[model samples]
Target: MIAHVLDIFFPPLCELCREVLREGHSLCGDCAANLKRIESPFCQKCGEPFDGQIESHFSCPNCSTIELAFDFARSPLQAAGPARELIHALKYRSRFYLADEFAPFFMELLEQDERLSDLPQNTLVVPVPLHWWRQQIRQGNQANEIAKSFCQSSGLPFLPALQRIRRTETQTRLTRKQRLSNLHNAFRIREKMREKLTGATVILIDDVFTTGSTAHECARLLKKKASVERVIVLTLLRG
Candidate 1:
């Protein structure tokens, strides 16, 4: 009654299609029915999904040669269609609530990977840091916002475990090499937080994992500075 009347006055639109979502769904039923998650047969080292073909078993073209610093990554969905728009809205449009909306989905998504079940205790969840200057311009760090919501819901402590020391423009059109170079030495462990990270495992959260250069660099610094034991990157999508 009253709730239905309110729906007439203030309907909630689907985050992806902008259609009216019926009651509790974020995506309209049709959209939800078709949205694809990253089902397995994925690369063990990099988390890229595959069809289990021989060709699909190869190391990702971008990361084949160099050793990846982090253990592995877990992404909730394929980075396309509705997932892309949803990520962009949260990353660029400042739609922060989706961070909370996506957290449980990420938790479930990660569970499908056998490695996630044995997560070591004292594992700290950290967001890839944004430069203070750009964070000022954007009014906030999206990763931090996501990490905050994820921690509140999951009971895992969120730590400001990484700091950005430089600002780079968007990485949208950059090559993987360019992305890697641009992020070089851009992050460091804060001195006060350094002591707490020794031998702790970490889960680095970000809105998307594209070339993974940014997360790689951050994890590299974490290992070098704080002696953290393991780093697992987690994101809503792998673009």
Candidate 2:
């Protein structure tokens, strides 16, 4: 076949290292192994990594008194090293195909994490929306792309139920309090989309979880405005 011959002439290479892939793989095994994964002993509320032994359902001291809208948060990889490179490629460089590589890995993480096993069966996968102006500049929403790929692989439906109503300042240098204030009232569910969210569980998708200001605001809107029963946040990387 023409496709078979083309493969012989131009084999697929790793996205990061350009090493030849070993059949049906995008990233070479070595590069894949180099990705830093987020494991156990993390905060129950915010999913921050902890250094010492902690009992199940334990909240990190940082989040102990902080009230979050989502039931829990999780990420597959730490936001560093190869994971950071892949995120940057997908987010800033417009390497959209990298989403295909992230979808399965995220699913694997979801399955392995006991914290997520109890998610309501009526869950919907929703990506945090970008402001319309920001979306125009980016040419694409990486979070939606990742959510779409994840839904395709998992047979769960993807919902663009939430909209970013305000265009705020860049959150890069903002303190946690400032980030929260900046994102407050920044999200609203479309009127038509509101009905679909009633009594449904939500899995908010994003590329990274930093201070969680964005996720919190989105979840708050979904819960208070949409009457959603529960919200759980999931991202590719935890900062």
Candidate 3:
């Protein structure tokens, strides 16, 4: 009741549509419904949507040789339009409330994507981390906020299994090679916690899967340090 009164005074609005809403809602219903899901016949490796169904497991011709160590990857929403706007709001607007509003969309993909459906009920959720300095400036890391909220809602374990050892420029502004080079030696497994990760099947969580370099590097370190069986990457956006 008090919350509702506050909402009446302040007027909650959807980040995507700017429509006024009742208390406890972020994105309006229609805007939420309009979010696009990634369709089938996409790249097996990078999760890039293709025109039609193709036969190869290795669908990414460009990065196939690089070999994403993860078992599979998926971005529930294609990064464009409302999807793009929502992500920017979360990343720049510093409104983690959006992720709490937006997480169900990511979780809904589990029903459509077989890989996500098969994730073990007890799986560990690990969000890709930003360097401590960047996190301070940003107030919070977007991926960590999403993963933490998801864990709380789903009753899954949230793990800070990886760390950004060095600061790097934003991947958005860098070329593919530059992104890779910049991220190299940028991550390290928490030393004492290595044993805990040995047999763990990890769901590597992030906000977006742009070039996949960051997720790739994180997976690489997890593979090398922990001898983990599989590292699956999950992101909100596939571009």
Best by TM-score: 2
Per-residue accuracy of model 3 over 34-103 as CA lDDT, tens digit each: 8888887787778888776576555667667677768778888889898888888888879888788767
Distance from true location, Cα of 167 in model 1, Å = 0.9
In the range 6-29, model 2's lDDT, one tens digit per residue, is: 878998889878988875457877
TM-score of 2: 0.94
lDDT tens digits, residues 1-239, model 1? 99779888989887777888765446666665566788766776677877765544446665677777887887878899887887777778888777766776667765676788777788899999889988887778899988887788677888997889988868888987888888887888989989889999899999888778888898888888899999999887887
Question: Which model, 2 or 3, shows the larger lDDT?
Answer: 2
Which candidate has the top score in lDDT? 2
**Candidate 3 at residue 227, lDDT?**
88
Candidate 3 residues lying further than 4 Å off, grouped into runs, are 53-58
Q: What is the TM-score of each candidate against the true structure?
A: 0.87, 0.94, 0.91
lDDT (C-alpha) at residue 152 in model 1: 84
Model 3: lDDT to the true structure: 0.82
Q: lDDT values of the candidates? A: 0.80, 0.87, 0.82
Give the Å shift of residue 197 in candidate 3.
1.1
Give lDDT: candidate 2, residue 136. Answer: 82
TM-score of 1: 0.87
Worst 10 residues of 2 by lDDT: 21-30
